[model samples]
Target chain A: MPIIAAQGLTMRFPRVTALDRLDVSVEAGVVGLVGANGAGKSTLIKILLGLLPPTEGRASVLGLDIAREGAAIRERVGFMPEYDCLPPDVSATEFVVHMARMCGLPPPAARERAADVLRHVGLYEERYRPIGGYSTGMKQKVKLAQALVHDPQLVFLDEPTNGLDPAGRDEMLALIRRIGSEFGISVLVTSHLLGELERVCDHVVIIDGGKLLRSQAVESFTAVSGVLTVEVQDGRDALGEHLHAQGVAVRPEGRVLVVDIAGERTYDLIRDGVADLGLHLVRLEQRRHHIEDVFTS
Target chain B: MSTSTIHDIGYRRYDGPRLGRGYLVRSLYVHNVRAVWGLGRPARAKVMPFLLAAVMVAPAFMDVGAVLLTDRAEVLMRYSAYAIYLQVVVSIFVASQAPVLASRELRFHVVPLYFSRPIAPLPFVLAKFAAMVTALLTMTAVPVVVLYVGGLIAKVPHPLTHLREFLLALVGCALFALVIGALGMAVAVLTPRRGFGVAAVIAVFLLSSAVVLLVQNIAEFRTNFSLAGNAGYFAPFNLVDIVQVRLLGAERTAEAVPDGFISGVLALLLCAALVGGAVAVLYRRFRKAGLS
Candidate 1:
């Protein structure tokens, strides 16, 4: 069963409509909600979490009606907001324990879960230090630890990789994937960067200007294209000219030549052309369509 | 050294008993109360509240000391008039701590985290409101209790009468805590910045008391005592004082208090309105903040 289902969900602010007749149903796994800023990603999450009432239509989370059973739904869900919401004065352990209690965990259970989740998030001895002194990467880890400390069935992580460096971003993405696969928790993570989501999400839902643009599996969005990418050590211009004379559709894309595949002959033609030119072959492989190509196309 | 393998227990799901809304509210209330006292926080956060609490209880200790030394009943401070005597300290305590309880979450954008849980906005606001009231009650009642206990130790005459006055003064403290806590929270929640919240809370108390005192003095100078008494309702300290003097049979501390049983009932209703109105405002404020 789909963990989240929405129908004609609309959110209208006075000056602008944040969401317009949006409909989306997502199965449990690592699902990505991809949208630009002001594309109603946060609004849709708020509606799904039952924090905001929709102007029209209906939705359900974990098979419970969002309009009526929000409390019950929230009982099983965790949320990590995009903005900086941690109080700087308290240590990470203290804050996460408090959040655990907020989710109705008993005192002992709250403390234990807080410790366990902090450890899982790679925060050990430094968890005792005040969050005010934490780096941006450490703070994000703390935020993530609090969300998981409650032992939720599903978690909503809104832009969890925001404000992180490249290494931190990769670590956060890996952690999010583990949350879905190893932790056995369904994750609905949002990001504006499609490439990042492509790496972690099993299904990607793209929205633009408060409307659904596309919703498909990650494999479908990144399926192998019918073009081959050819790279050579030298004589790149000669290779392109030779491939063109052989009636092969080829174009130079930087150091590589993009050749439209004409059956299996395209590979043989590239191999023979490189051999005849005495140019060392670096790579010859079919290019897969990227998630970004969906937007550009 | 022998090679050892690290164990990976993995993430464990909590299949234990999950408590209900009441438990969540209780946890939030406890957390807020501790925050108000700066417990579980840095030592620097503890300094202001502890210093103010010491300042609050010092005079009672001095009064007890004087009674022990002089053996005179008059040396003991009046029970109902204790808060009024140390009104500045109480106000400072409320001003400083109200922001700690009311605005900390708002300033840090933590309200959404709470609302996203199973708790509703009303209960969230009520828990905070209750925490502020609890903090204020403890601040005001501890000294009065110390004074009473010290009096008993010092052996003031008519122990029963002292007990009755002490009980009535305890009631007065509740009223004071409720009214002042409500007003301070209402003011502080509007200012999300801690410094601004503190300034705003203190300014509300100071400005309202000053205006009411000015009006009371002018009315008394004109020999319109009833008008002066009615003006006392405008200030939070004097509002609760009216309830103490008129309804609880305590000695009047304010310059003038409205006469008769009807005035006392009206003062009680006004106190209720203040608390109810503040709760409503807080509910709306937090609900809006949660969405933001």
Candidate 2:
């Protein structure tokens, strides 16, 4: 069963319609929410967390009805907000431990679990320091620690890579990937950068202007074989003519000639063509697409 | 589900302060305290109450010498510190106390953080009010002690009666602190900007006093109809002052339930109303800002 499912979910802000009749479902594993700013990613997560009431929709997280069972859903699920909220005065250990206790962990257990989660989030050395003194990266780790201290079944990370430098961003992304793969925790992570999500997410949910543009496995995003890219050093026009004469689909793409391999034997024909033209084939490979490629067409 | 995983810390289903089967109130309260402590300025955390103590004591020391000069210096000694001088101290002390309690939070933008935690907005408001009151008590108690000892060194009248009055003064100070602190906190809650909070507090205090002063002049020069005659008696905080004054049976200047008590009562009622209204406003604001 899908761990999270939404059908025709629409979220309306005062001057904006955040999510427009969007439908999405994720069974388990890490799913990435990718979109530009104002793309309704945060709205969807807030609604799921029971923080915001949707304007129009039906949704569920872990089989709990979002509208009626929000408290229950929130109780079982964890969320990491995008902003810098950690009070600079208190230590991470104290804050996370308190959160664990609030989540209903008894005193002793709250303390122990708080310690474990802080270490897990890579704040072991600075757990006792006031959050005010933490680097941005450390603060992000504290936010994550609080979410995980109670051991929720699923976690929602909103723009987790935001505001980090390249190196910090890479480390955060790696840690996120491990959360899903190593700890076996289900994650719903949002990011505007499709390439970053492509690396860590099992499923990718693309949204644009508060609408579901696409939703599919990560493989569907990176896999494409419909268009063929061919390179030739000489007789590029003749090669195109020959390919057209032979009824193979062909188009000129700048210096290289792009073709549609009409049959399985087209590779052999292309090789022969290359030999006939005495053109050294610089490179020949199936065209693999990036997530950005889908954005174009 | 009742059993624990090997990696589990093995906590039994928490039956310990069932804060409730599922009420979100307790969670909100827990979250606010956690967030406050988590922000981690321990020195400031401790300093707030300590500074509040200073504000409460500052004014009472001015009265200590006069009390020691009197024939009833013992009465001044025992009563001056906590009760008799408490109103005088707090009336002026609240000027600074109101801003620190209300405005500082506004300056920090920690309001959204408080609202967004897994807690209700009301608890955040309540905890802040509580913190301020605790600070007030600390600031007031020390002056009461100093005046009591100062009066003893120059004993004149019944020392034991002074002690009884001092105890009453403590009660008076506590109630006074609650009403004023609640009012200040409510003003802070209304505006997320510290400057606005401070301005609101000063405006409310100054306006209330101005209105009372206008009424006093009307009663003295133009109309014999005192606010006492018009029913707009300007004494809300008088009850605390009443007990403090009443303890001095001989030295008392006016009735315990004077216009100030009426004014104090109105202030208290205004505080309660403000807390309710502010919480409702904050609930809407928090939801809109995505705090919860």
Best by DockQ: 1
- Tens-digit lDDT track for model 1 on A1-297? 899998999999999898999899999999999988999999998999988899998999999999999999889999999999999999999999999999999999999999989988888889999999999999999999888988899999999999999999998998999999989999999999989999999999999989999989999998999999999997889999999999999999999999999998988999899989999998888899888997888
Candidate 2, residue B276: how far the Cα is off, in Å: 4.4
Give the DockQ-based CAPRI class for model 1: medium
DockQ for every model, please.
0.63, 0.20
Off by over 4 Å in 2: A13-15, A88-98, A106-114, A124-136, A230-248, A252-257, A270-282, B1-49, B58-118, B141-168, B199-203, B206-225, B228-292
TM-score of chain B of 2: 0.60
Q: lDDT tens string, model 2, B2-65?
A: 1122125322222333133333444444444333232234665545434555665665565677
Please identify model 1 stretches exceeding 4 Å from their true place.
Answer: B1-7
- Give TM-score, chain B, model 1: 0.96
- Taking chain B only, the TM-score of every model is 0.96, 0.60
Q: After superposition, how far is residue A99 of candidate 1 from its true place, in Å?
A: 0.2
